[model samples]
Target: MTERILDHPVLGALEPDQTVTFTFNGMTYEGRDGEPIAAALLAAGVRTLRHHEESGTPRGIYCNIGHCFECRVEVDGQQGVRACLTPVREGMVINGGGPLPAPVRDWRKNHA
Candidate 1:
């Protein structure tokens, strides 16, 4: 059977001709000019985002929205950044397979 090349829910309809090449862990992947980096990775069949710091469990996009930190990726040199919230730009480098610790919430911020 022929494998279906076109797959995706919301982004499948978006036929973006303007393509930009970027590196993810020294490997190259093509993505839309302004789409999210996570979206591009998802389209390319990249499931694992990063590994847990302790348990070493694989991570991926749990929530499409930015509320969950499962889609976090290191862009350029910064860490703990939500890939879903970050828009893909030309020459951007994405790094996966890093230590992703659980998020810490401070109650003081809400009281302030």
Candidate 2:
């Protein structure tokens, strides 16, 4: 992936924001504070978020308004988290659609 620094025509001289470090697929990446996860990933040249669970098809940020679940990712210990709606935070651990935590069964299948 190529470097994706934005050079906007209308918003000349983009100001740098407070940066926060977040891990994506075990790799550290820098993102602006309060920025959406998808925007941060796109700026870093990361197009694919995860592969379809059934077909293994690559999925990326689509309908960035949080209408579509194409940008779902695993964050910390949570599964099926929507990246487009989530803000970038310091020390966030992100996974590239890896295996999710097993579903809760019988309300206490494993807890009991």
Q: Which stretches of candidate 2 lie over 4 Å from their true place?
A: 1-7, 98-112
lDDT of 1 by residue, 21-89 (tens): 898888888887888888888888888878866456899988879998988788999988888888888
Record all residue pairs in model 2 with backbone atoms less than 3 Å apart, i.e. clashing: none
Query: What's the TM-score of each model vs. the native?
Result: 0.74, 0.79
lDDT of 2 by residue, 1-112 (tens): 3254557688775577788999998889988898888888888889999986644579999899999999999889798889999998999998877332346333345566
Model 2 TM-score, all chains together = 0.79
Give stretches of model 1 more than 4 Å off.
1-13, 100-112
